[model samples]
Target chain A: MSSKAAQKQAAPDSPQRVLTGRQFMLGDHACAEGALAAGLDFFAGYPITPSTEVAEHLASRLPAVGGRFVQMEDELGSIAAIIGASAAGARSFTATSGPGFSLMMENIGLAAMMELPCVIVNVQRASPSTGLPTMVGQSDILQARWGSHGDYGIVAYCPSSPQECFELTIDAFNTADRYRIPVFILMDEVVGHMAERVEIPEAKDIPHVPRKGPRTAPGTGQFLPYAADADLVPPIAHAGDGYKVHMTGLTHDERGYPSLTAETHDKLVHRLVDKVRLNAADIVDFEEQDVDDADCVIVAYGCTARSATAAVTQARAEGLRCGLLRPKTIWPFPEARVRRLLEIGKVKRFIVPEINLGQMRREIERLTQLPTLRLNHAGGAMPTPNAILEIIRS
Target chain B: MSTPQPNDFSVVHPIDHLMRADRLPHILCAGCGIGTVIHAYVRAIDESGTDPDQHVCVSGIGCSGRAAGYVNVDSYHSTHGRALPFALGIAVHNPSLTVTVISGDGDLMAIGGNHFIHAARRNVNLNVICINNFNYGMTGGQVGPTTPIGAKGTTAPQGSIEHPFNLPYLAKACGASFVARWTILHVRQFTDAILRSMDKDGFCFTEVLSPCPTSFGRRNKLGEGLDEVEMYRERCHIENGAENLQDLDIDIVDHEQPITVGNFVDIERTAFHA
Candidate 1:
């Protein structure tokens, strides 16, 4: 189907994937289908609430397709193995919720530092530690960006629906592979359990990113694993090929070994962080709903965005010039565009109805310096359309 | 799949022929039993003719964590307490990849204690060479799972009153398929323990009584790194697994009690990795 045909079928206000056939699938299940569509060949994960379905789905499906799925002993192992598998020339992913994401932070930093490309699906849940494994929360936004230690760039996408779960996961892999960094599918427990309609297009309909192939053989040619092309993202040669690339958490040179010199560390840190910051616009995927000519805008993401969209539609019926600025990509946040909306004085006030106690609200307010209201919760009970509409009306 | 037989291969050094044992990649501290223990493990691999490429060694944070980096293999250094989980990743990803975890005592006992216990409980086909250095040697010489009674360290400025973890008993309690313990001073014995642990088809935990001299020794007046080596020599008793901790006297050859150094448990269990 053409983009317009699909968009028209989906319409502005319609049941998600309106024209697509549906069967029962949890948010995490849709995410697994998304990974499969994205050519996911390796899955390493520890079973956690809400996110377990993704692991379960991949475990059964990946092996059938001749891919590898490993239920790692824990989330730390889950992300570590994913990095190793990715470096070994496989599209890899892992799924977890709450504390599991915390456990993955260190190695995820290593993935970011080493510029290894892979996807991490975090099915958000209430936490400080096992706080409500079955319940949902959006408290990990700030954590997702800064969770992994050190200064670097990362791409994180939040999908509000199972279909987005399916779609964004593929985009997550594509962006990660293309840029050679870790990408996150930040879904919360609410979206994780939500069974929705999703149509997975043909493999040909989807785009796949194979890593940059080697320029020369191991012995004859020079190929620094950390050496970047004109695009600024480095091409890696897998280990077995014997090019001898190195990876460490410490600051290192292009050869991938530990280099203590200040100049080497500076260049390593700069290039490591710059590529993502420089090309964030191309790497980012976000959605701009009906925000033009609006006096009020609801800026939300994940499941909250779904409700905010409904609230926007309901408020419009009451003759309120309100719109929803739902972000499909959360990190490297759609700052330029959101700021553009404020800079041109397009929207008066942005309202963020997230599950947290104003996590993303402060961000919106800070960037736009506009009055933004946070209709927040800890995510056990999802914010209803009426709750969001009340905030908009207020 | 090619079962390695030690002595069939040439006995060569890891980094170089005249390798300054100090220049080893793991960079073991002066008195660490793990460095010597790794020396034994490398010797076994070389003597046994195991292809280092096919052998993937995994390790967690802490003192013994650097073993994977030192050895010439498809090595992985995962986060603290997760060497087992990641090793399971490599093992299941390629069951033929002789996956092993060389983890530290504090790493396995305190933080990753759960993964260690569960991996033992599940019997995943991964070899775990747990170095029980008795305290948090890498971070600070704090009282750890293997820290004996009255052992003073950075954390327990006063002699510790907390009961120390007995590595053999813990692994046996956790249902580890093969469990053993030996200090670095007992090089041949420790290597013997590792070789036996490696043959297990399920989760194997070989807790080596490694010493940490820098943090653990100096503060406790156990002497410097090499000085701490004598502690391991004097305190350990070569038990044949015939007696229990309760039966063994904690007085002679003792750190509260001479460590029960032997293969305490080995049972045929199904592998979870497959």
Candidate 2:
């Protein structure tokens, strides 16, 4: 039997409802639902801990929604397949944890060079190499930014709750489509496995951005596959569309053929890096609280932000003027808004807490250049509220 | 060299529309057999009667991998040794489209061997065309997984002691729906095999023995690409339905053994998409 037919046999027909109203769900499941709600039609992934639930949920849900789910042989193939599927004009994604993410690095570079729009949900686990498969670690934050060799920009989102897992996953897809780049949903193991009450927004209320294909028809005028529009992003034409598009990882001109020259290489690489770098003003997003009147601020993200919030609330009651600056979009680092918080809010000291050896904390220090203290924690565990509160008091 | 006179060649090339004309003259050296393999492949694609628009060509990094860029179709030049997985993505997502993976033996069999065998085991319905040139041509003719035993390469100057892979046997063992081997010298049989694999329903693989004259030939005393083609003419034998895949290893130094080539396996199975 065909895969689609088998999928139909495995699933019962239900109403085509977009939102599964208020209910308690795991962060991983919310991520899967978020992908479904965002019109995900292809999911190619390898099963791994902390992130396996995402593949499991999608495997069960995708076929019911007329989408295809392929559990590839390895993470290398999983990421490669998603790139191919996305190149074929399907909104595609994949999920992996530490070891699997390492395997995907090479192809992730390919996706960036080819400018294929796809989402990668990396449910973070403790690792230098399989350090803690079932425990939380935010160490991949740096890896997500600079893991793949070479200079290119990527958008990574951190979700602190299951609700944000659902909400931000949809946003990640939209961001990927708009930028024609691989966008990352960097979820820690705690957020991935933790269950919480998630409010699924009305389908009509949630916004989704679709990929922009070539404005002119293929075979009309010359179709330059890498020809950037005014916004520095090019329209993607899918395979089997008669576009006859040719793409490569090697540096190419606007025509998308490999042209190994200094001029072409410079132009292509600069444009790729600048697309997100120049558009940082529009792409950077974060959430701030009590910062307008605060003198001390705590910067955090992902699961650590949850602890940071409790610590901040307790510190505020203890007569400390502390607030929270939670970055929703980690890359494109949100420097302007962060600088504004320091200047406008007259913040003196900054406390950054993360579930790693100070990965994102360095970015905060570099961007703000303020007196920052890092509440660093090793992998396999998270910092406690009182632990962060102790730092806030200091 | 003087250009061919206007009347010396046909005014209108029949398969010109199927190639990226501006990118020619290609990077392959004059004696390389890769160009001929591509020629046979385009002919097979033409004869297969599938809409050209419905076909996507994918390749990994190598001299043979450049086939994807030259083809006048939606082609992706993927990372080294990852063509099968990339093609799998295209094929599995759009079952209506035919995704063909054309890459070199080293790129597919060495670094990418895991993806190749697993793809066959899953029956992904990809047209995997492996061009075996005995060494890594683009990277200066180093010994590869398919380099014949006792053959000389830059890395194996004294002579390679490693036992090379029997590609068809590997594919067959991995449960490929169809497996075949041929040389660029046998254009008719090679084209027919390519056409048959393209028309097949599951994981189909074809190994084409081509010449990398600059890399493999110069070191092994095989002369130029054309000289290797002549050697293939004298040494190659069609052994269809040969049961002993283990004995199919190529020993270039051992002239007593004939290089066996033909379709060794073909059967129907449930494809991943179908």
Candidate 3:
């Protein structure tokens, strides 16, 4: 019954599609390659600076592998298309920048509410409104966490280098599938544009996570599309799979019907949030360096983490007790690790350096309630190692 | 409440197999035409002889958007003004599924207008059923892009001075492979139109001119739902293959003006791909 187009399954990672070897590649290109490796079946995107390469590269690469890529009318359509594809049981995604990211927020919330699995790559540029479209910014850190209007939990990853961009994008798709929610690769313009070594492993070696499907057989007349098990995640039934699943953006019950009661809303929303919140230990990932005995911890992510790592090294050479803590998963913000660092009573202060004025620093301050200083940059440029060192010295 | 025994309900609805009968007592008000349109849609699905499991219905937010929920298919009720792109995603990803987008006028031609034209222009293979009740019925009959000029709405209490779109012409101009319009009163034709659209390969559109008696009808002095159907019977004329689609604009304010309804455009076009 499948149409000719539908019969063309996303080709297994071929040598032509997957550049399986160590090679210098742009962060955006590496992100696309990573999606290809992760068995991406569909991608919809709009052209925005720092993120356009991700789309442009995928446009050519996806077709080669029999996967589909669509340049949608706008960011709104791009995100909407990916959500639809995801609901249809395709491993789908979309890439955008700050302004486009803002346009995608409403649909992102829908994906969260519907518990659809899709990846979103926000190659963030400086912005409130089209600020430094071609330059770097980490200001969207908070936006990634709170841009979509709602209380649902989301997963976001901040990759500091091209290699991490490739690696974390796969993780983003896996996490999205695991939780049946939208996962974000919150990349900055520097990381998106910078060229660095990306080690692409063989397709078999790359870890991939397929979507969970209902154990209930088709035509059983017993499948409840939104009935979650102990993990609070319902197995998704793809459209046209004879499951007759009805999914909606409205608050729904276990049957996926619009149950607009306060009780159903409360239960549905709490499950949406708890799925990730309870699994925070497994979802949250970070790298801590030289923090066994340090008085100051420099917390950072994305491109700024590179500068923080340099600053930590310089502080150590200069006989100062400073360390670096970089969060790979930004949302589910490594609170436990930061709290543990604080409880040890060794880390007295935190200095967060980023391209943004102060986004992640606010999280650190809010969580630890300690003296936290920010090495601020209003984007278009990254803070130098010396600038971060000055904050650590202070 | 106790579950009724099988013997207690001897008579089953003819289209019950294709409907979420459990979700009945639908949200539609008395005299609304959305129910009729959904009926024709489900009837067409039954007559199509295709696997019911291979059908997917998607709807954006509005009165007509509820069609997705009521349809006993793998369906999705997406956000407002996004059903076209969402359906496009499904259609493009898995063309095996006969995806249909059922939405209201404001949901399709207003906020979702961009997606509508682009999807048509790309010739995406999906069926679109746009229920045009002249105003935003769910939002208390506010003025919308399809509300005829000089028509009264909640937002335009005096009259809607803005121009409304001629939906059939818009769809045709946007390169739809098949374009048709029918009032809900034309139940048989409407069902056949939907069935015909399901057979087309590229983008196909069927605009359903429905009545929102509670919200739009009362405000515009269009009387009850039956009165609106009577009006359609009086004014509507089937004109298939009519030339100069530009003249097919609907004028509710002037009862003397004719409402042209027919399968206006049907031609082969290459469906969009990656």
Candidate 4:
């Protein structure tokens, strides 16, 4: 297919594709809208707590805009279906919580190995296995990074409110398309369920990224599907397009044929990791306030960052030097900024507050090696602003 | 110029254009029937008259799953027990493409059973081919969901105590539009059945009883792969319009019982999309 035809099939400009202007919306519902704006051609999901609203909204909305949505038999099928759709050159995604996310790990690894671009939204809830399904938790930070076995690089965005949920979900899709990797939107139960104002821009204002098509023409017998360009990402060809591409989960050579040699595996694995790692400067995003001359910096993300922001305001009113550093991109962990804060030498200590038990704290501690304090709650509730204030005062 | 001799190297196999000859020397064991089944499948595709580019083959993890890798078309070798859902994704997203899943009995009937029944219940448009070798041939002949009662596998040295599934009946019960059964020895019938299924509108299933001489056949005293083919040739009977599918079950231990094989179900239904 021509690139123009592929783009038209992927992103149809229907009136129902976007709900313009500000409106009161749940975070999950806003996320569904973001996907539509990002030209989501397909969505396959199994309903799970704290994330079902995204699937429920898309069920009716997708059909209205000439897209497809399928509620699969289970989480395993959900992930697998999206991966297949992605390989067929559709912008696909799925939503789930902790338990369902656990079921999707194996196929997530398959998607990584195949280098299929898709999005996965995980609305956080308490869990060691079905721990509070209806409550809030930020415990899945590390799980999002290393849940799938093997070495690969991933991109994840933490949306703190309904508005960020709308914006970051679109960013997630663009990143997934640009890098040909699975990007995640990590939302907690608080942000998913909270009703707030979400300003959705018109469809023209939304930035859309299309999947890169094969450079070679069909029937030329020269199309190597796994051959990477200068960006270390391979172009994809869909089924029925006559490229006759072969994709497998095994270690493959540039021709997409299984090559079970250590040299082949080592080359493929390193490219998978370095594609995101070397481009971290462009992938990572964060927000900071009053950190230029502060005695302590509180690093947080997700809904906990909401409370941390308030704590910083309260500390300023009481003549204390406290600042808030909120990370928007979690996986490409915003390490450069944190390292800069440590080297600036104005900060005496770092405070990390989250709903989980010191998940993000360990990341900060490892990166900075400075005095990092954890203000943690197991789940079901956010850390109170005063609790975080107390850590800052210490 | 003199006529080319028979030993001249100018001639190639007829189906060479439809296969990835560079990836040859397939991983199937000696005397296995999967290669024959693949040949029949490729012949059916050729006969169907559909654009080769529009035909996609998906497979799960097993020896038979490698069928996707050999076919020179847009194909995928997905994770274990997930080919049905994966193919469902491709079919639903692009209805113009003809999607087929070729997998083993253990991969399909055991681990992927839920997906199979649900896909049939929804009447999704897909052609699913299950190669039943009566055991997990890739894993060295362990007892699988289709290992008949009183048969011996590596894991069932004392003889398998559990009953096997009647695949056609299960597929018919789950509302498939077309269902059939055949052995690899019946290549003409198998290829025709595959073409018939491909021409149908909803979920279609075909079970091919193949020989695993290295695994299931060696342990069960079934002699070589040719001997197993002879058994299928002598013991198999055609009963296309049988009323009671319940009697279609196979008992390999009972030498007196004849194996029933036919294209049993063919009807129309609304296929699932989106």
For model 4, the docking class works out as medium
Compose the digit string of candidate 2's lDDT tens values, residues A154-204. Answer: 999999999999999999999999999999999999999999999987777
**Top-TM-score candidate index:** 3
Query: How well is each residue in A41-100 modelled by candidate 4, as lDDT tens digits?
Result: 889999899999999999988877777899899998999999988878888989999999
Q: Candidate 2 — what's its lDDT? A: 0.87
- TM-score ranking, high to low: 3, 4, 2, 1
TM-score per model for chain B alone? 0.85, 0.95, 0.96, 0.95
Clash pairs for candidate 4: none
Listing candidates in order, what is each one's chain A TM-score? 0.92, 0.95, 0.97, 0.96
Find the number of clashing residue pairs for candidate 4: 0
Give the per-residue lDDT digits (tens) of candidate 4, residues B24-93.
6688988899998888888888999988898999999999999999998899999999999999888888
Per-residue CA lDDT of model 1 for A1-394, tens digit only, reads: 1232233222221222122345467889889988877777678888888799998988777665556777766776678778877755668899988788898898888788767788999998876677877887898898998887778888889999888999899899999988888999899988989998787665556777777866877654376667888888888765345454445565667765556798997888788788888887887667766688888888889988888888988999998999887778888888888777887796778888887788888778788766777788876777999998998888
In terms of lDDT, which candidate is stronger, 1 or 3? 3
Clashing pairs in 3: none
Best by lDDT: 3
- Which prediction has the highest DockQ against the true structure? 3
Please list the Cα RMSD from the true structure of every candidate, rounded to 1 decimal place.
Answer: 8.2, 2.5, 2.4, 2.8
Ranking by DockQ: 3, 2, 4, 1
TM-score: model 4 vs. ground truth = 0.97
lDDT of 3 by residue, A1-394 (tens): 3456645564576676678898899999999988988888899999999899999999999978888999999999999999999989889989999999999999999999999999999998887799999989888888888888878889999999999989999999999999999999999999999999999888788887777888979999888988898988889899888999999999998889999999999988899999999999999999999988999998889999998889899999999999988899999899999889878999888888878778888888788878888788898999999998888877
- Candidate 1 lDDT by residue in tens digits, B224-255: 76766676676667766643734432221145
Fnat per predicted structure, each in turn: 0.12, 0.77, 0.87, 0.70
Instruction: Give the alpha carbon lDDT tens digit for every residue of B109-128 in model 3.
Output: 99999999999999999999
